[model samples]
Target: MRDIALLAILLWIIFEAFRRPWIGILGWTWVSIMNPHQLSWALRTMPFAAAIGGATLLGVLVTRGRRDYSQSREGVVLILFMMWISITLPFSMVYDDSFELWKRVMKIDVMILLALVLLHSKRHVMLLAWVLVISIGFYGIKGGAFTIATGGSYRVWGPENTYIEGNNEVALAVVMVIPLMRFLQLQMQAKWGKLLLTMCMVLMASAALGSHSRGALLAIAAMTLVMWWRGKNKFVTAVGMVVVAGALLSLMPAEWWERMNTIKTYQQDDSALGRINAWWMAWNLAKANFFGGGFMIWVPQTFAIYAPDPLDVHAAHSIYFMVLGEQGFVGLILFVTLFTMTWFTAGSLRRQGARQPETKWLSELGGMLQVCLAGYAVGGAFLSLSYWDLPYNLMILAVLGRRWLDRKEWLKEKPEPVIALPAWLRNWFRKKPRPQALP
Candidate 1:
């Protein structure tokens, strides 16, 4: 039943794409981020993402819409980084493995470029934001409930065969989305809706803490401090945050505390030692090779050559080191520069939007996105999620929000209708009294 339902939805999305290619883009984002097929038994092995992406691409070709991406600073730097990686692929120490990984990265980049072209208006931006919230929030809500039910004894995990499948990865992902949730909450006018979102934020935070990842702990702490500083009602926000942290920490088991305590004594932990070994290997490899070792460079052979302890083979747990090793110094420079420009751009957009009465939502969106990126930048230091799609999509969203403000496109979004009741209830009441008037 679940398989059939998912297939039906995919088919409908494909059908809709021909008429409105943007629908295809939304469908693609949903599949890429949620990995819904992975949750179903029969559909688990299907190439749903490829199908959705292919359909979306075909839709783009057929539909009447712009196909070119803006050559913004970030976009140009992104392309340069992409080209540099391709150049390094040929020189890869593991050519076959590198080619495979390169293919995966290119697919994600292509979708990102396509999204930038299609997602232009405020409606498009809001809809995409909701899709993002729903995709990530599902795991957060579920994990939080699980943590509560099990007393935080076990770690929360993401869907199988996805970027966030690991406990630490999902925790960081959850931490990132809390701000997006808050952004959505800000756009909402209904009291009940606002409360629901506020609850979800708490649950999502719980999910992150439940993962018991030491990196997640640091990431959330950094994210919380930034959120408090930027968030309105600062003193209240700070107090609520502190109270929530204390409560969540109190819920955690002794074993969880023991695991987190290792952060202070990392020198005594084998996992920490292994990650350090990998970081050293990445640094040494980048210094030795012009384009670094290319993809799949975490092999024993490379470690034997560059690692401090040749026997200790570990993946580059840090995104900084991951790019440094895989793409070399120039590539790392481009990578870092792209994000630095994005950060400033988001800040500029936030200030611009805050000054305008009509564009305040953009202000809120930009601020939350910065908070989201904060979590990614901090937590990602200890995870090898260098090519994860969420952060990149978020960066694009920030760029798009800035574009909207620059072009005065806020007029495209109609203000929410004023009503004493929801549209559904209003319509229902209106229908019952209309028969007498008609007669």
Candidate 2:
């Protein structure tokens, strides 16, 4: 039954793609982030994502209209980064493995470019955000509830056979979604809506802690601090953060505390020590090979030459180190430049959007994206999420928001009605006569 339902939704998305390609893009994002197919028994083996990608491309070609592509330095840097990785492929320590990973990365990057072109409208941006929040927040909400029920005894994991399947990866993903949830909550006018989002935020935070990830601990702290800094009311934000942190920490077991305390004494922790060895290997490899060792450089053969402790071979646990190992110094430079420009661009949107009521949501969104990026930056240092789609998508969102503000698209758009009502109801209100004043 679950498989049938998921398959039905997949077919509907493909059918809709021809008329509205942006829906396909949103569908692709939902599938990728949520891994809904992974939850189903039969549909798990289907090529749902590939099918959606093909449909979206066909939709783009079939749809009749002038479409715009992003022409920003950020986009240029991303493309350059893509080209650099391809350049390093021939020099890859393991050619077959690296080429396979290259294909996957290219697919992700191509969709990102397509998204930038198609998702330029305000409505598209909002829909994309909704998809991201709902998809990732599903885990966050479930994990939070699970934590509460289990008293944070068991660790929360992401969907099987996905990037965030590991405890640490899902924790970082959850922490990043918190600010997006907050941004959505702020857009709500109804009291119940606000309360619901607020609840989700707290639950998501609890879920992050419940993962018992020390990296997530640092990420949540960094994310919270940045969110507070970006907030309109600093004092209230600070107080709220403190209260939430205090309450969540209280729920954690003593074993969780013991695990986290190892951060300060990383030398004695084998896992921490192993990560350091991997970082050294990355540093040594980059220094010798200008283009680095390319992808799949984690093998014992490559580590034998570059790693300080060759026998202690491990994956590049840090995003910085992973890129440094796979793509070399130039790739790392491009990677850093891409996100650095995006960070400032988001800040620019936040400042400019604050000046008007119509664009106030942009201000809130920009601030939250920055918070998300901060979490990724800090948390990514301990996790190998170098090619994660979420961060790049957030960058595209920032670019789109900036484009809208710069072109003043709101000026051309019809003002959204304060209250949408049925025609009959509106006509009745219009025709109804007012009572005479008592003279």
Candidate 3:
């Protein structure tokens, strides 16, 4: 049954890719809704590896035919850095498990390539927004049903699925989608279409609260503030403020309130002290192994050396800490470089849009991309989510790339010959078209 379903999905993806490549971009969305947990596991191991391997093969075949290497210098640098990380790691420590690291590297590489290809048109951007609305709405309804059936506290899908419990990572992903959805809402002409988008916003906001992630809550608050500051619409600003205030009041539970109020207690609590100790241990290890300790090694080593019982040890809570401990300074630098490139690219696109206001679609796309990147930057501080988190984060990156590509295509144009029209039509009915100028 699973094989058959997988085959069906692969076929659908191929068909969509041929007919509308943007639609194929929703491959992750489909994966997320149908079986988020399994997809998450697949992202971590074999499934993602196979998917990436296939994407690489497809890229090879396509490139062979087209022979276009118009990749940016920053792209080349990023790819080279990824390759360096893969090769530099000490695979000899556990040669049998080396494939795991390679799989992770390949998955990230595949996502970048996929994003670049899928984002080459405007239609793809619209398709991505549609998928976000549909998938998130489905999950929201599912969560609501579960909540209703088992009272407010009981999760419908149980602990097996992180999203079922309204996981912080999932909340962060939804928050990232907000700007794109808001942009779509602005562009959409139909009344029902706007309504659907408004509902999506509400549903996503609700799900974010359901997850009870303090970090995600903080991130969403920050994102809302940024959006309000950047947005020109006074009505949207006012509505957003009210919605945010209401969401906070309605969603926060007594326990959550207590936790927030006592967050400073972490400094004194045993669990908090443990995290501090873990950070100290991670710092010492990172200092000793300046290059890297190899992927997934630092935690186990720290557990063995520092903790009285090795069984109790787990990952360092902070993403930066995890990167430092596992991948070392070199890996950390590469990670920073990747994020920096993404930020710079998004910012550049926004500036280009601002300069060329006549290109409305391009300007909107750039603005949305900037907002999403900002949200990710804020979210990453709390969550260890990287390209490896799969389906969700990877999918978000792919959609952002697709939107940018669409804007790029929109910017490209040829000069049209000027034509004289009938005096009556030109003077009374038809508006004169503005002269086309390249930005």
lDDT of each: 0.87, 0.89, 0.56
Model 3, 241-274: lDDT tens per residue?
A: 7866675456555665665554467766565455
lDDT of 3 at 255: 63
In model 2, where do residues sit more than 4 Å from their true spots?
Answer: 415-439
lDDT of 3 at 299: 52
- For model 2 the TM-score comes to 0.94
How do the residues 1-439 of candidate 2 rate in per-residue lDDT, one tens digit apiece? 8788888989999887777788888999899888899988788888888999999999999997437774888989999999999999999999999999999889999999889888777877777888889998999999999998898999999899998999999999999888888888888899999999989988998899999999999998898788777667998878877887888888889999999999999999999999999999999999999999989899999888989999998999899999999999999999999999999998988888999998999998899999999999999999999997988989988998998899898888664552256689889888957899999
Q: List runs of model 3 lying over 4 Å from the truth.
A: 1-9, 15-56, 59-68, 91-98, 117-119, 128-137, 144-166, 233-239, 269-274, 306-312, 389-408, 411-439
Cα displacement (Å) at residue 370, model 1: 0.9
lDDT of 2 at 1: 81
Name the regions of candidate 1 deviating beyond 4 angstroms: 66-68, 412-439
RMSD vs true structure, all candidates: 3.9, 4.9, 9.8
Candidates ranked, most accurate by TM-score first: 2, 1, 3
* Residue pairs whose backbone atoms clash in candidate 1: none
